[model samples]
Target: MATIKDVAQRAQVSTASVSRVLSGDARTSAEMRERVLTAARELRFRPNAVARSLRSTGTRTIGLVVSDLLNPFFTELTRAVEDAARAAGYAVIVGNADESPEQQDHYVRILLGRQVDGLIVVPTVETSPLLHEAAASDHNIVLVDRRAVGVDAPIALADGATAIDELVDHLVATGRRRPAILAGPDLAGSSRERLAAFRAAVARCGLDLPESRVIHGDFRAGSGHDALAALLTGDDAPDAVFVANGPMALGALQHLAEAGGRAPRVPEDLALAVFDDMPWFSLLRPTLTAIQQPTAALGERALSMLLARIRGEDVPDERLECRLVLRESTEPRSAR
Candidate 1:
């Protein structure tokens, strides 16, 4: 197998020079670094990341554990993180937790075992203690999108407070009296944050949001379908409803279209709004109103913080702001 020695010989340099170049030592001249890298690439000489990490030189990689791959927000987060990580001259190892606490813990353990330099995780609801223990042990952990229940790690998130207020005020001005919410899972911290923001906005706008109007879903399309169906069948159905995510919003639209006699047309029978803005949302018969979070910025900031933490730097939490985009579904465009 090709080794550092082979690369060193190919580059006409000593093994120590090759090591310095491969370890990202800034002292190495750019010409020497290029020569070493070209030789390593030509020889297909791969470094033993574990061995390098044992010597405290790092694997030159970071691990990212996503909350759920199905969520478009997370998909964008992954892309943004990859772009930032690559630009920083590092590799990324990604793990999909599927929004399960057990799966999240398992992936975290695997990533730690792989000896990645640091971790960027989106904590699941009721996450296990291993994560907290790792953070306490100084494993260079950083939370993305939401804070864990007990982990005291640095966090990066997107705040939707102003957008929620704008949505509520817009609804009130448009003559909508009753508004409801199709919320995410009750146990998730992020879900609670969103619910709290919506509730506060409703109260501030002088709108009534009864406990019965809050329907919890599992942040999936199917659960959104069922939740919307329940709300629509209730004795006092809402005149307007807010969906917490893109997939759920699409699912609720499906239920609305197929409810036969109970079906409510967008902005006419029932106005609809959502927290996440997707490209396809604009192409729907009635474009959806949505709040667009700075997902790319959130992901980039999380990685930047994680990298700093890996370098033994203390970092503060970050909260990016979101913007509300009103469209036909909210009667802003007056499509009907």
Candidate 2:
């Protein structure tokens, strides 16, 4: 309930002087500003955000829209974005689309309605129209993780093709001829790119990947487990599997443990490689081999791009590289 007037009275200064001090007006005397700040802190005074936003035309808030909150990839990205935004003196509002176009559009409207200073989105393919509308409206919008088809917005993305190529090359070099892939939903922008790269790599290696060896699943642990079960139970089980994300990799591992089936034992029966370098991956039973995306850097760079756009600066689409991390799960065939 403490107000600016209370702080001004406690500091023995006028309300105008307190306002100047709080706003960081350079014209205010340093000694007076310190006194007002000390009084405000002692009184537990909080500024009226609504009034301040109305006056300054800035809410100091950035909206972040992600496809899935449960995925560790997005969770880590969110943490990084929140931390970077806080350091830059902005608050973040996160919205999960659940990979649904309707939900994505709903959150977009809500964020705009709330008058957030800017938006960063991992867009669904169906929401491209909505994104285009927002972009045409002159709203500050930046794409993160996924780029839209027809919309031209500042973007931050991983090099999906190169990452997948590296994984394939490693598998081939390790003496794994029959390789399977568990890919995320093809509608997702990043997923589609990964699938394309995977196919191209297989072709270049003079390997033919039949439709039976590829399974499509949502980027969830359960989906991964189910996909692996389906593949292993079928007639043609692969000598190696490349899972696109961390959760899927874990799920596949879980299924392998429970099935008690023979062949493709860790590094011997079947080698495993996946995307995303999760914190605990290195400590797992076989210590997973992974293609590590710079997730923290991706989140930080997305925030920086958004902030720059909010400041009226022009930014272009960007792609960050992925590093391959070798571990016991993908030991050379001879060593196994």
Candidate 3:
């Protein structure tokens, strides 16, 4: 309940002097600044963020929206983003889109209404009129993970090309001719990019991937489960499957379990690999091969790029690389 007046009295200075000190005004004397800060610390005083934002150039806060909070990849990205934002003297507010465009739009409005200095989003849809308006109005927006089709903003995303190459090479080398893919929403930039890379890599290895084997999901476990189930029950069952993200991978694993009990023994019956890596992946029954994305780097870079945009700096789109991590799930055919 301590106020600016209380701090001013405790510091033996006028309210104006206290305000100047708290605002980081260069005109304040060192002795006066010290006294004001000391008084604030002693009183446990917290500034009114709204009032401070009104008086300053920024709110010192940023808003981040992720497609799905259930995904460990996004959770780690959120943690890294918060860490980087805090290090840069900013606070972060997060919103989970849950792969719904309407939900994403709602959170975008809420964040904008809260007067966040900037926004970073993993857009759920291909295009959004609201996002375009915000960007056009100089709202300091940055796209992370996936780029909205019509939103003209700087973006930070993963480059899955090399990882896909490595995955295809491994599968082909292991004598797996028929490979399947569980892709996320086809409209999402990240999903599209990953699918494209997968196709290209398969072609590079001179492997054929039928259209029926390319399944799309909503980046959720249930969708993954359904997609994998369809593939498993099909007449032309694939020898290997690559899931797009972690939650979906978990779903695929679950489907594998429920579909035929212990019939599928990973590399023996159906090899599996996923796009995103997690600590627990190594502990799974057969262990999982995955593409390790630089999640921390992606978060840090997104914040940095957002900050730059907020400061009126031109920032180009950034794409970080992902590396393939081989594991028990992708054992060679001979070993299987």
Reference-based lDDT, each prediction: 0.85, 0.83, 0.87
Off by over 4 Å in 1: 1-54, 332-335
Q: Higher-TM-score candidate among 1 and 3?
A: 1
**TM-score quality measure for candidate 1:** 0.83
Best-fitting candidate, scored by TM-score = 1
Model 3 deviation from the true structure expressed as Cα RMSD, one decimal place: 10.6
Question: Which residue pairs in model 2 clash with each other?
Answer: 264-269, 264-270, 265-269
Give residue 239's error in model 2 in angstroms. 1.0
Candidates' RMSD to native: 10.3, 11.5, 10.6
In model 2, the Cα lDDT at residue 204 comes to 95
lDDT of 2 by residue, 1-336 (tens): 998778977986655456656766575667887889999999999988677658356789989999889888999899999999999999999999887888997898778766688889998663477777567545688898777876768899888677678788988898999888999888787877777889899999999899999998888889899999898888998888889888888899889888766635888878888878888999898899998998889999999999898787989887999888888998886785
Give residue 165's lDDT in candidate 2 (0 to 100). 82
RMSD of 2: 11.5
TM-score of each: 0.83, 0.81, 0.82
Candidates by TM-score, descending order: 1, 3, 2
On a 0 to 100 scale, what is the lDDT of residue 154 in model 2?
A: 88
Model 3 residue runs over 4 Å out of place are 1-56, 260-262
Q: Backbone clashes per model, in order?
A: 0, 3, 0
Clashes counted in candidate 3 amount to 0
